[model samples]
Target: MQNESSGPDDIASILSNPILNTDSYKASHYLQYPPEASAMFSYIESRGGRYDRTLFFGLQMLIKEYLCRPITPAMIEQAKAFFTAHGEPFNEAGWRYIVEHHGGYLPVRIRAVPEGSVVPTHNVLVTVECDDPQVFWLASYLETMLLRVWYPITVATQSWHLRETIRGYLLKSSDDLAQLPFKLHDFGARGVSSAESAAIGGAAHLVSFMGSDTVLGVVAANHYYNETMAAFSVPAAEHSTITSWGRERETDAFRNMIARFGKPGAIVSVVSDSYDLFAALNAWGTELKQAVLDSGGTLVIRPDSGDPQTIVLQTLRALEASFGSVVNGKGRRVLNNVRVIQGDGVNPDSIEATLATMDQAGFATDNIVFGMGGALLQQINRDTQRFAMKCSAIRLGDEWHDVLKDPVTDAGKRSMKGRLTLLKNHHTGEYRTTTLPVAVEGDWEEALVTVFDSGKLLVDMSLAEIRSRAHAHEG
Candidate 1:
């Protein structure tokens, strides 16, 4: 299929075509529904996996990027031709009807929990239904893209849990929580599968921490979440930068980094394991200690090799032995001008172990930071929280019927029934999932608010507001 506008425009059009965005199996689903079927309802939830609560996010980004655009004839023709060859049935009449009657805007309504709110798993997080009876299949058709929200939601939830764990350590061993935001830094950009994954997953990590080395994540948050600057990074050295100086000139390389970026109040990270981590520490403490102190900046030493839980404490003690330490009001040892960042083998378990070791050693949590890469962005999957979108209710001939899946083999896989609405009691501050007897009405507030309707964005959230909600849940 071709368009009047060629090349990039055509590619963009084809890539952005919502009709073609779904699974090939969905292309044949429009005809499989009952002839009297006029509306279909489906909802997404975490069927209970890694964490108890999930942080709702990424829907606004999906809506603005994919659903808001009106479909075109070229897209319909493209999908038809592709589906013909791919052996899946195409709904040409359905596509043309949507284009002609609804101006190509999908006739669907999306209600979702507000982004950044952390709610218990196995509860409805988002609900989809067709607004136009003529397009009863639209709701499930969009599931292919809508369910991708699980990626960001999982990343955000995991990051929030990491923050809570770190906060607990800090509270136990430190005098202040001022440095909490910069504790866990995102290093997942290069580790993600795609640019979109890096952008979305990186932005999701920003919901918890203010530190990140993923520039694409910062750009994503600014573009999609309306934040001026969602996260920040300091000048940091990589293995290549340190190793480039040659083993003989490693000291010079470290000095050069301090000279270039070690201004007052600035923090610079240097990967010290390029040669011998202990030897490098000795040099920094003896030969380079004065220069480091005179530079009026902090040097964050990164130990990228060895066991994280053990190496982190050793790095802290070595730094203290070189620079010495002072007892803070909290009665924990704070290293003088040096800090440690454990960037290798970092995960939730390792982070907790490292912090526990530090606490037992009487070191302040403020003396070290963490940099997470693949585990933060690429390691999680839909099953990380058992995320699923299933049809819960369908309308046939003016009668609504509950749709459910009760797998006797696995009771945990049993799906919800009927139209569902998430309700929160203000008096008790508790949330419950209940079946809506009919269309939602009256003063009974529903937690699931309409965020998208017929190609229009009903709610646009910012990163700052999202971060606030995510943090507030912990309180």
Candidate 2:
């Protein structure tokens, strides 16, 4: 978190030195390439896993945060000292060649499908090549850092798919899609491994929905993606705030939340299952019903534990009995002012199941919202989308040769050959991946654009722009 003005001691303490961010073996890779090799080309793709399509994102953040910075001699000295004792041959000359010639800006060119574009699996999402032949290993050396982008990309893809799932149910059971964007809220800040994960993954989820409790995510969007405000949250209570009031004073604690946050035109959430969920609901419907209705704002009830599908329906019926409900034109019942949110054990699968059950019971999808924690940000892995960056082509003595891996044991692991480019067929609206030479022969629109070039960012996309591109296919 230190600024540029921080002293060398502060900078050295941080583990983000670009040279040291890669796998240890990579330090010796420059010596492993063919002696005649002049340049190398690589591409990244989703080999195909959980989702058929993948959302391209987070590359801008990576480029700006890690690649754009100039590598210093001090960092090189530090890396050399570490690699020497670690039994790896450090490419001191190759790195100095970059500092002397390219001024330490990475001599690499990156072309990628515009961020937020949902490209089908098995197609090239990004291509990387060294801008300087002398540093042919530079592009591949960055694979460790660039490939880390898989985290944000996977989170965005999952969030988008979950949005589509919620949209379908809303169409069938709700009167309109007005509340779709706020239906899924990010509650994963506390569940993630680090602050950076919370910021990156939280920003990814915001690409689909606008409701989030992760404040750092909102800050990330504002700082990285040029958004003023990316997500919204309301004053809400947690288990501690309720339990702190003593079991006997639980009703008083509930009333205090309403009095504090339930102003007109506002929404406040309160966890009501501290002692007994049914008992609390009875109190709200009987003694506390008038106070809730007179608050002039919506009261969101939260049930932290239970089978989400069963509990959501039960909670909806209880709210109906207390505050009453009305059948909308869609023929689904909606509870007045009061609503429910299920925060525990929530994921896309659970949300789908609960909504399906509610729709079947003639209840609207708008009756409840979802608060996702660990399952939203931390549960997925790189293999969740089977993301991989591979050397597809290399240059030796001015002749470009195809470099690929096609093991018969696992054909799914086969990689592309030659320099790659992604193209979208104008007539069919389908995407195809082909060598750069072949891309010129078809009636296709280039899907991959130059996003980064030799220490410069060519495109800067905003969160609103990304959100729009991500949902463009829906229309």
Candidate 3:
């Protein structure tokens, strides 16, 4: 899609397009915003209404359309009034000044892993360097967008790791030739601070992995996944509850649920860990499996309690022993067809531990699935796992100043000095060292580049494309 456009004409024209109503761009909570009224007019009038197609338009769309918060007329009018009071001639430099001075654009050099590359701890994921002496003061404001981009990269990296672990288990236990049909569901909405961040977090996972259940993630993922892997699933709630009264009452309630949504051939998932997870699994496992199979449907059982490895093993064994290994006329085995999904407190460490435990217990990994919530999406986020942002070098007068933070605390937290060069190890191909200025600049290639330019995406990449890139890099 074209980058967001500036001026009332472009906004008006683009808003009229019917394609916005599609599943990808549906007006969900993350897409809804208070209408911009005289704000546009006021901003135009203050600047002599001369639209030079500024990059701010793209930034605005990211903030307003994508973020989808209350951008009230009052706020817009206030911004308009501020711009009118400080309006300058319309030009790239002038616009840069306006943004830098009032709109807050600080030139900070950011060194980050390539968008889809997997990164580890203490690995300097990004280094933001500013030429201005006072740019350090604005670091907190930049934190919002900086972390916004970085969090997804971190989450995607973790997801990639967890998926690989699962895949390895599947290869060892199940038919290698059969398609696994994997999915990564983002369940971090509750843990995230706001709807916008949650959506972005979910979108990040989808970009590096597969479909997400978060509706906001659907919108964000649509920005990259509209043409590939177009379908996804949403859970009814964070957890399942038969009700608040009694065990028999809850069972009846659950039965009523199955009766109410008795659609044949539908893929339905239910969290089965309300009161005594094992008991619920025992009670509902047989009936739910038979109901789905008998009706030509598929039942995905989600267990979100106790040890994941143990629960999954027990659940799978029960299903297989109870249902038998007979494939229906539709070529779907009743035992193999029922998927055991594990959610609640799933992270890289937990995923690895679960896989190791399952392997040790001799359980088939093919019968297991995962729905990562807080651990994958929220916990190891950029905010939690921070990359250092430091001023390594600065130009003062005629000489270049090489600055270093004196090691008064942790050595890992110490900042390096000079305009350093990151060298890739010739043998391992991993980032080796941060060398001094004496190293040849010609040998090192600039890492960060403008992926988006002139109000348009310079590079068109789908989520699958990014995942393929990540997989190739991994290999």
Candidate 4:
């Protein structure tokens, strides 16, 4: 977030000094890779189809952080000492050039499958290019920044998979498919590593779902993707809010929520597992039945413990016995003016299991929603989707070279080669890689677009556009 006026002779640039790896030197970068290579074309892909597709995200933030921001001379001087202390060789010449000309703009072009595209694993998600071979260190220097994208994309893919899972059950269980988008709620902000992680991971979840409690995720979506309002949250009470009122006044806590947030269309969620979930549900249906019914708004009961499938079904049964139920067109029971939200022990697999059980029990998907915390945001890693950014093609002098790594020990680690273009296999509506640089007429449309080239962001994507694009890939 700083800029430099004069060039650094002895000091290293602030941004490029701290490398994630010990041997991440621009001058001696990727020693095993081609040294004469002037241009490095690195691509990101998932090794297999663990999920439907990888969502392209977080690169906008990466570009904003490093390339677009001004690099102050003072920041570079500070990093120089840190670099020496860390024993990681810094590329002063390469960084100094960036600081001088492009205002810390990284001298690289990153073309990729658009963010929110449901790209199949083993298909190319992104490609980074460097024009000058001598200054190719900048390409490797920025690898750390780009690799951070893997987790966010993995999280997005995971969330999308769950979305499709919920979508299928919704179409079968209820006639109103509009409610499918809000079926999965995000509560993973507290479970993540940091604020930025919460934001990035949360934003990934939002690409598929509309309900979230993470404010940082809302902020991340707005700041990075340029959305006016990214996610929605209803008035909800946590354990602290309810427990603070004392155990004897538990009914009063429930009453207070109804009094404050209860309206014709306002939905309020209450966490009911502080003491007894069934007891509280009974009290709401029997003792406080009139209060909830009189509110005229939907009350979403949140069961935070026990097996989510069992707890949700029991809660629905209790609600139907007291508040009553109406049969949907799909022969599933829908509780009147009430719903259940399972926030605890909810994940992609668990959600699918819960939905399947609910369907078997003659219950509609409209009667329930899921809130995922750690599993939705924090339970993923770069390997969740096996995302790897490797140099598949290199340009040296005037001749272009195809680079690849084939290890006998692990065939999955083998990388793709040559000037790659992501093409849609028309029959499957899925993406595949091709060595052809240009799209053949009527054969395939190029999936990779010039998102960021040189010092400018070529494509400006909106979150709404991204969400539509994401859902378009749904089978």
Instruction: Flag the better candidate by lDDT, 1 or 3.
Output: 1
User: How badly does each model clash, as a count of residue pairs?
Assistant: 0, 0, 1, 9
Q: For candidate 1, lDDT tens digit of each residue in 1-475? A: 7756776347767788888889999999988999899899999999999999999989998999999999999889889998999999888999999999999999898999899888898899999988467888988888999999999999999999999999998888888798999999999999999999999999999999999988888899999999888888899999899898899999999999999999999999999998799999998999999989999999999999999988888889888988999998879999999999999999999999999988889999989999999999999999999999999999998999999999889999999988888976555556678888634444445788999998899999999899888898556
Looking at model 3, the pairs that clash are 109-129
Point out the higher-scoring one by lDDT: 3 or 4: 4
Order of quality (TM-score): 2, 1, 4, 3
The C-alpha stretches of model 2 lying farther than 4 A from their native spots are 1-14, 439-443
* Candidate 1 residue 371 C-alpha distance from true site, Å: 0.1
Model 4 lDDT-worst window of ten:
15-24
> lDDT per model, in order?
0.90, 0.90, 0.49, 0.80
Q: Is candidate 2 or candidate 4 better by TM-score?
A: 2
Model 2 Cα lDDT, one tens digit per residue, 334-383: 99989999998899889989999999998998898999999999999999
What is the model-wide C-alpha lDDT for candidate 2? 0.90
What's the lDDT for candidate 3?
A: 0.49
Encode model 4's per-residue lDDT on 33-96: one tens digit a residue: 5666677777777786467567777777666655665555555666565666777665566556
Provide the TM-score for each candidate, comma-separated: 0.96, 0.97, 0.65, 0.92
lDDT of 3 at 135: 30
